[model samples]
Target: MSLVLHLDTPAWRAHLAATCADVPGLVPVAKGNGYGFGLDRLAAEADLLELDTLAVGTTPEVAEVRNGGWSGDIVVLTPWSRHDPLAVDYLADEQVITTVSRLDDLKLVAERAPRARVIVELLTSMRRHGMGPGDLPGVRSLLSSPQDSGLRFEGWTIHLPMKAANALAEARELSSAAASTIEAPVWLSHLTLDDYRTLTRELNVATRLRMGTALWLGAPNTRRTTARVLDMHPVKRGERVGYWQHRVSQDGWVVVVSGGTAHGVALTAPSPGANLRQRAVTLATGAMDAAGRALSPYTIDGRKRGFIEPPHMQSSLVFLPGAATVAIGDDVPVELRLTTARVDEIREVDAEA
Candidate 1:
């Protein structure tokens, strides 16, 4: 019994190929649960795509890609700091490119790993990690005399906000600002293909688009997630069940499913509520959660079921009241957040299958 992610191999590969053709200098991001396909699988797919570079979220993830047989250059998207214990080990690797967002960290890299390949990150609207515009001159001066410090300046990176009303405009402003100070390739994220093309046309220096969700999960029809039905028990009205011993309101079946909190079955990230509709939905969901009538991700008999209580570590008890029938070992379709999901196995099927 497990939570399985099934991939339509040919269709997914075709999508990946098409994306690579459309986006120039595409660096596929394979990090943080690997978009539910696992890190090793994405790295191997990157090798099969024959891409020159792969972007990961952290420095420690560099080894996962290398172990997955990705021999090309690996760029860690997270800014490297001297406080990171594994920084030195990853810095010394020639194939590894570290992102430095702070001036002090850039100097640290020069002092520790002088010959390290480095990318200076510029602060954009995201403001997550990057050096501010005010610090660009210092970076430019430091890179101007690279011979004094053996650090190899690869390029500048800017991570734009996904929800910005006009991402391309923000990217253009930031890209232009960096190019004016120091001439180097610009690596970016969260831009449409047209926007990227527009930016490329507008800028003189080279540009690369780093994509994670758009690259891996672009084809929604090519992937499916499901959980196996482990067991089922009939319950009468007012009968208490589950670890919390919550009383049932009516006669139903207590169906045990194979995914729970361990697999991110019911775990949800906080919604940003950018607009009125989103805020309304969030409020509705919160109201339901407070009432203990939250919906589970599992769908059986073409309807979503509800949890008897909060999910357990490896299994969940779903309440299927009236009419709906499910047997043991049946595959129940699941709607999961791919980035947060951790499935037990991934099965690939050909398109014809």
Candidate 2:
């Protein structure tokens, strides 16, 4: 069986509603592989929640939200460049908010999208895009022009690295600079609970948090994935099963079940260890896990099972000592991490006796 994305719609949505409930305003980031749920799907859900707007990673994904019957503002995180002509048309007709980083990029938006909404992306530690503090004056001059060019300067944007200490403090500095530069709102990422409260008081302007992960896929450890155990058999030491022809180390059950590299099982990443070799070890481990969506915590007889060997392309072999208690066509829960199995298909089967 191939991969099937098992979606717990109500559960996921409820979690999202609760996490973002505290914030006065929210701008859900619904771009870039839709963070595994696909773009249109995320937009539809965002629309249902009646968020202020939906943030996308790139311009192409705008169509995804529009196609989903969303009429809210489409905020593109990518900096506006003269390279893309369509930016003008979208800005003119739709509620598109283009993020401008460089002065030239801002000029491009002004020239092409004279009547467009723009957000000045300030430079942060990530250094992806955004005008630095030094460039603030130039940006203000463009906006302060007498003609105004119908350029609606709504706010500024900045993306911070998650899990970084003093992330909020760092953001406050940028936010302050942006606010001092213009009277527009602030759009940001990589902020913590304290940062929100502190900035909320320090910066007196409309602010929108362009958040994902925490808002949509928080506590990834809790989510579960599963597949059916297709078949099973007994094998002894020195016996070979898989096409690789590797000998077994012990007399354990040679269980043939569903799942493989295609499902993103064995695919894992290295841990944050002290040495380069330690980091390399994690990367190598992730490569195999990704290859064979090996069952890390697959449910068997209402209990999870363990893997015998690395997973194959389309199926995984598990050492099932409880195979007798369990049976064929049983549901196996695979506890999946969204960071690893962010976007994947899962196959579920009817549980058997």
Candidate 3:
């Protein structure tokens, strides 16, 4: 019994090609569980795309990319510090580009690994790890004077917030500011095609787009998570079931399915916004929980099923009201946020078949 991610490889590849076609100079970002497909798999996919560079979120992920057989330049998006021993050791490689967001970090890189390649990250509206516009002059001065330490200035990178209505305006302003301080290409994230087109038209420097979610999961509902039913038992109306012994309001079948916390089943991501609508959604979800009607991802016979209790580490107990049509050994579809899911296996099926 297992939770499996079934991929339609042919269709996925088509989508990948189409996604890359629209965005030129693409730097595919493969990080954090590889967007539920694992890091190594994405790295190989990046190679298939024939991209020149790949961006990762951390230093630890560097080995994963290398193990995947990706020979292209690998850029670490996260800001680096001399305090980090692994980054200090690995940043010396010519093929590696580490982002520096602070003056101290810039100085450290110059002193420790003078020949190391670096991309200076500018602060954006996102307020993540990056240097402010004022920090660029000093960085330019350091890059201008070639030290034997060989600190190679690759380009500039900026992470943008998704909520801005006019992202191109912000990107244009930011790109102009970055270029004025130090002439280099601008690496960006979270920009629409329109935004990219507009920015590229106005900005003289080259623009490289870093994308992850839209690149891999371009087709909606293309992937599915299937869990095998392990056991089934009849239950009486108002009968107590599950580990916490939650009471069932109606007659149902208690199902033991092959998925739980370890598989990322039923785990909720943090809410995105604190706006009224988001607050209302949170309140409604809480209300459902209070009423013993919490929604479950497991779907059987084309309908969603409920949980008998909170999921376990490796399995889940789902409550199917009324007569049980499902049986042990049967597979049920589970709707999952792929980024958060962990399946035991991933089977890539031919789209044509």
Best by lDDT: 1
**C-alpha root-mean-square deviation, each candidate:** 1.1, 4.7, 1.5
Candidates in order have lDDT scores of 0.91, 0.72, 0.86
Error of 2 at 178 (Å): 1.1
The TM-scores of all predictions, comma-separated, are: 0.98, 0.81, 0.96
lDDT score for candidate 3 against the true structure: 0.86
Candidate ranking under lDDT, highest first, comes to 1, 3, 2
For model 1, what is the error of residue 282's alpha carbon versus the real structure, in angstroms, after optimal superposition? 1.0
* Stretch of 10 with least lDDT, candidate 1: 81-90
**Residues 1-353, candidate 3, lDDT per residue (tens digit)?**
68999888888888898888989889999888888899999999999999999999999999998898889999998889777787888777878899999988898889888888898888888888788877877887888767643688888898998877677777888889989877889999999978887888888889999999888877865677899999999999888888898888888899999989888888887787658999889889888888878878899877888777788999998888888889999999887787887789999887678
**Ranking by TM-score, best first?**
1, 3, 2
Q: For model 2, what is the error of residue 122's alpha carbon versus the real structure, in angstroms, after optimal superposition? A: 1.0
Give the alpha carbon lDDT tens digit for every residue of 293-332 in model 2: 3345566656555566667777887765523655667656
- Report the C-alpha lDDT of model 1 over 168-250, residue by residue, as the tens digit: 98999989998998788999999989999999999999999999999999999999999999999999999999998989989
True-vs-predicted CA distance for residue 277, candidate 3, Å: 3.7
Error of 3 at 105 (Å): 0.8
Q: Could you tell me which residue pairs clash in candidate 3?
A: 114-149, 114-150, 114-151, 115-149, 115-150
Better of 1 and 2 by lDDT: 1
